[model samples]
Target: MNFVKRAGMSLGARKPRTAALLAIFVVLCTLLLGGFLLQSAAARQEADAQRTVGVDVTVRKKGLTPALADRIGAADPVHRYSPEVPVRAEARGFTPLVADVPAPEGDGAGQREQGPLAVTGVRDLGMLLPFSYGSTKTTEGRGITPEDAGRNVAVIEQRLAAGNHLGVGDTVHARSADGRREVALKIVGIFQDPRRDQPGWAPPHELPGNTLYVPVRTAQTLGTGPAKVTEAVYKVGSPDRAGQLHAAAERILGGGGFDFRVNDKAYRDQVRPVQRVGAFAGLIVWVITLAGALVLGLIVTLQIRERRAELGVLLSLGEKKWKLIGQHAVEVAAVALPAVALAALAGSLAGQHAGDALLGRQGDEPVTAAGAPDTVTAPPAVRVEPAAVGKVAGIGLGISLVSTVVPGLGILRLHPRSLLTDSE
Candidate 1:
């Protein structure tokens, strides 16, 4: 009989065993394709969300100016940029007794309990409200509004209020580090910092008790320099525009030593959790693939022993050993072809479901306008793509070949005399 006919007959005769092996291959392919597709989708979603990660450009030695901020605000793709002055101001009529202040820049450096508090004054003090991540809002009263600017108004952190025995309708008076500037402002609201991380690891100023939020005008009154604000914040739709933003900033600042800090942490935070998931999923897919290959190899190896008599008969008729190996390889490919098709269908559906589950969670910002209201929704999601299908099909074929070839080697070495003689 021809090798193709022989392979067909052998597969047809063991109907139950063929079905069992076919099911296993299908499952293996399905899991492999599904995992790969889901991983790719997750990575793509992270990349898309990356566009929303805001950027910060700080003027270390040279303070930011209102004219530069206005220019940045008018720039294309730059949304909701703000000018701010971060200053060290001493709190009068109150003393900080808290011991949680972090070590300062230099070795063993830290603020004395009697030291001045770090204050940030912004044009949009409300933007620093709790609604924004890396920000906080009032737990008691309310966040500072635009009306607070050009007035003696401040938003006190809850910790600051607790330490000072103050609340809404109270006052927080402070003098700038140079003592040349001083401001006494009424506290219209009290806020609580997220303080998610331990104070030891966070930036010293980010600590709850250490900061005070006020109007940009108030900051200017408390800070002495040619420039009014210290830094300018820009949300330029996507991080890929870093170059454009840098160039624009340089043009606005007349090309000095200004520094731009890209805040890609939004994307990082979204992806970091899923990265661990992707790595573990990738490892599991490979392990399962290897196990499936070994199982298929063993099944093929055992088939050689069972069909020894038939194989010997063919060998006696002058059939080459390679022909026998080719027959076995052909059979594995036949089984895998069907499995790959079925897995493609099953895996695509399963993978999309998994991808949807991984895309976002609570507190995640959508890839749209910065500070966009809920009315502006994210677009529809893509379930699957052509590249994913091609990858699965190609890998499935590779798996079929590898699994067949490994055990086909053992089968080809069988001696015809031994095969014909072995009755069992």
Candidate 2:
């Protein structure tokens, strides 16, 4: 019989077995493809999140000084820089007074007295550490603009405003450490520090408390001499170049009188957790896929053994063993081709759903430790693209062909005459 006819006859005669094997192939292929897609999506998402947050380096100094901050900015390695000088001050003309209210003859009632408030001198609160309080803009009323640096203007927290009943354009008196010098400041704005929620050493404020913003220059003038800056903040050229820029800053400020610190170090430190999770997931998927392939190969081998009798008859009829082997091979190919195609399709859909679950469908929901959100959107359709489908199909086909071909070699040694006589 011609090869084509022989293969067709063999396939037609064992419809049930062929169908069962084809179903097995489909299930195995689907599992492998799904696992691969899930791993790829997870790794890509994690890498993207890490790059977005960038890295941070901190430089600390013995004392606040603008000289060192300027030197770091002028250095080649530093990409961007901002400076801060924090100082304490006391509110003047805001003394606590107790009052006595009219009461019955036997009743004595006196209001408790309040104490003077301590505050900090902030240069440009929003520039170095930009943050907002509820709905208030950090620089709303009048931030520390260059023009305001030398003037007696200030920005205080909302809690301070409420406690003192202070509003924009309200004049308040603040004094230096020795109470030797007092300056009048106009309330230009109100803001909250980002670190207000954190514990440990924090400025004396909770979102709306005693913290205040004044031009760094003005604060220096009010307290110490020479309007110096203790800390610096910079806007980087690009995240990719952050490392190089940081190195440059360190080199420039290494022995300078001040220390440089990056404000975003905490955010950068969070990337480790996301990376660990992604690596663990990838390892698990690979293990499961290899196990499935082994189980599938064993099942295919067993099915071939069960059909040995039929194969022997064909061999006794003067059928070229190679041709008979080809027949069985063709039957497997016919089933496996369509099975893989269907599996690939199913895998693409499964991957899309799994990706959504792992990464989230919302663009604004945080996906990484740095608080960066997953911005990946689902494609309009869940079907695998043609390119990806072709690659996966090629791999599946290769695996199936190998599984079918390797065992066919045993058929070549069977003697049809000996098998027939034994049957009688």
Candidate 3:
């Protein structure tokens, strides 16, 4: 018979065995496809979140001098840095809509309880670090601009605005510790503070509301001259370079009596919980895939055993051992390739859904007018490039061949004469 006819005969003769092998291939393909999909989705989300939020490193001292900030920025290890002075101030005459509990009987009633507000005076507020969350959501008007610095213009928090019925173009009063020289500032913008939920504070909406943004120069005029920055934000080349930059920053600022840190570690810490889930899923996929491979090997081995007599007959008739092996390998590949293709399509859809679910759960606010509350949207379809599919096909074929060959070896070694003579 011709090679095609012989190969077809061999494959057709083992209907049950071929079916079993196909089933196992389907299972393995499913496992691998699912694993790859989930991993790809997670990696994409993490990368996107990192870029969007960026990172922040803080340095605390009695005060920061412009000279120090400039020196740190100039460091060879540093890429770009912004110096910010954070101060607590109270809005005078304007009581926050939220009320503080009355002081206990023994507490000094005369002492003025200061409402906390975070006043960040930066040189170029926009360039130092982009205000990502609150610009368009302004309840009344625009965000702080370079012109606002030293001109007594400030941006207040959203909760503060809600409580006080304050809006853009309204004037708010603030005073330093001396209280003798109070500054009346115009409210140009109202924003949502990203740090509202920081430690020692309740939820942003619940906290006795206090937050404001102003020009760096205006901050100095209000109280302490050229306020010291507690933290600095940097824009580096890439995530891979973050470590090198961190090391460089540490070396430059190590002994300067201030802490030098990177935003990556903090960000990773915050997302550790989600990462752990992804890791666990990967582990499960590995276990399942391995198990599927072993099971497939065993089924192929059994099929080969049942066909031992046929293999012996073929060997005696001058069928080459390599040819027989190749025939069986082609059969497995035929079964596996189709199954993998189907599984990959299904897995890609599932991955897209999973990614959307995760992002939705993360509660990302919508970029909308009137600051409409964010709603979860379905994630885009998972895209697998032609290159990636080719790689996966190669891997699947390799796996199918290896599983078949290793188990078929037992049947390939049978002596043709011995098998033909044995009458069962």
Candidate 4:
């Protein structure tokens, strides 16, 4: 009989063994393929989310100016760049509720409870905070525009505006906390802070409600130099580029008396957990795949022993050893084919649940070493795509081939007379 006929008769004669082997492959393939696909999808989603948040790094120097900001903005990796001039301003018309905390050294030799409102200026108002996109979304009239440069316009926090009974189009007079210099600013916008109260000790100037954002030129008037900036903030699409960004800044700004602080807190808080889920899924894939291979190998080994007489006859009839091996490989593959096909659907459903369980644990808030609470990143949405299906199918076929070929290789060494006598 031909190879195809031999393989079919072999499977038909051993229905129980064929069914048992097929069921085992179906279950193991379902787990291995599904777990692998889910892990891959989760990893992609996590990377996209991290890139959306963008890595943050601040450049500070005693004599740094907008020159550094300009050079960094021109860099290809930088998505956004802002030159910040942080100054203290005393509120004239109203006083927003300040958190009661012991202050540092002041004009009066004694420690003070409240400090002046923190007035921070930026070249681009859109790139305000480091948390993520829309962290400081405006809810009121409008944000500070490029045309508003040198126009003395400000965007105040919603809580500060409500506390001070201020609204859009109202002008507020603010005097420099240390000097006699003062400026009047028209309220242009009010933004709401999406960040929750984080646990940790924070300086008054770092408080969201205590900040007032203004244009670069307006804040420059409050400083000594025309381009004086206390902080130069830059955004990168990924954390791995932090060093690259720092190098670019140093190369362009000519590093001296400067400090570079890179913060990937958003990536750490959000993407790290999702990656962990993917890693766990990947580990399971390897374990299940290895176990499945061993189980299938044993089954093929036993089948080879039982079929030794049949192989001895085929070899004695002038059939090549490789053709005999191919016949066995084909028989096992035929049994595994349908099982692997059914596994595709089962794997998808099972993979989704496993992925969700892993990600759910990551959703819990992280405890900080410094007793400060931080925001937890939300899990990214995952979907098994057609590509994943194709990939899983490929992996299933590979598993089937490996399981049969390795154990069936011994068929080449079967002695015709010895196998025939042993079978009797």
Whose TM-score is greatest here?
Answer: 4
Query: What TM-score does prediction 4 earn?
Result: 0.73
Ranking by lDDT: 4, 1, 3, 2
Question: For model 4, what is the alpha-carbon lDDT of residue 224?
Answer: 38
Q: Rate the local accuracy (lDDT) of all candidates.
A: 0.65, 0.56, 0.59, 0.70
Who wins the lDDT comparison?
4
The ten-residue window of minimal lDDT in model 1 covers: 368-377
Q: Considering summed lDDT, which 10 consecutive residues are worst modelled in model 2?
A: 107-116
Q: Assess every candidate by TM-score.
A: 0.58, 0.56, 0.66, 0.73
What TM-score does candidate 1 reach? Answer: 0.58
Q: What is the lDDT of residue 377 in candidate 3?
A: 27
The parts of candidate 2 lying over 4 Å away from their true place are 1-9, 52-56, 62-156, 159-190, 193-252, 255-277, 313-330, 348-353, 356-391, 412-424
lDDT of 2 by residue, 1-424 (tens): 6877766776688888777877877876676566556556655654554343434334556554666666665665444344666655666765321122333343222111111233444433434434311223453365565456568888776656766787888888877655667788888876544443333322232223666677666566556445545556653433445566667655755665544444444334434444554575566546645654465556656766776666668776677878866766666677767886897778766767765665454333332221111233332123455655565566566666666566767767778875465445
Clashing pairs in 1: 104-109, 130-136, 130-137
Identify the superior model by TM-score, candidate 2 or candidate 4: 4
Mind giving the per-residue lDDT tens digits that candidate 3 earns over 161-194? Answer: 8778888889988775345457788887776655
Model 4 accuracy (lDDT, Cα): 0.70
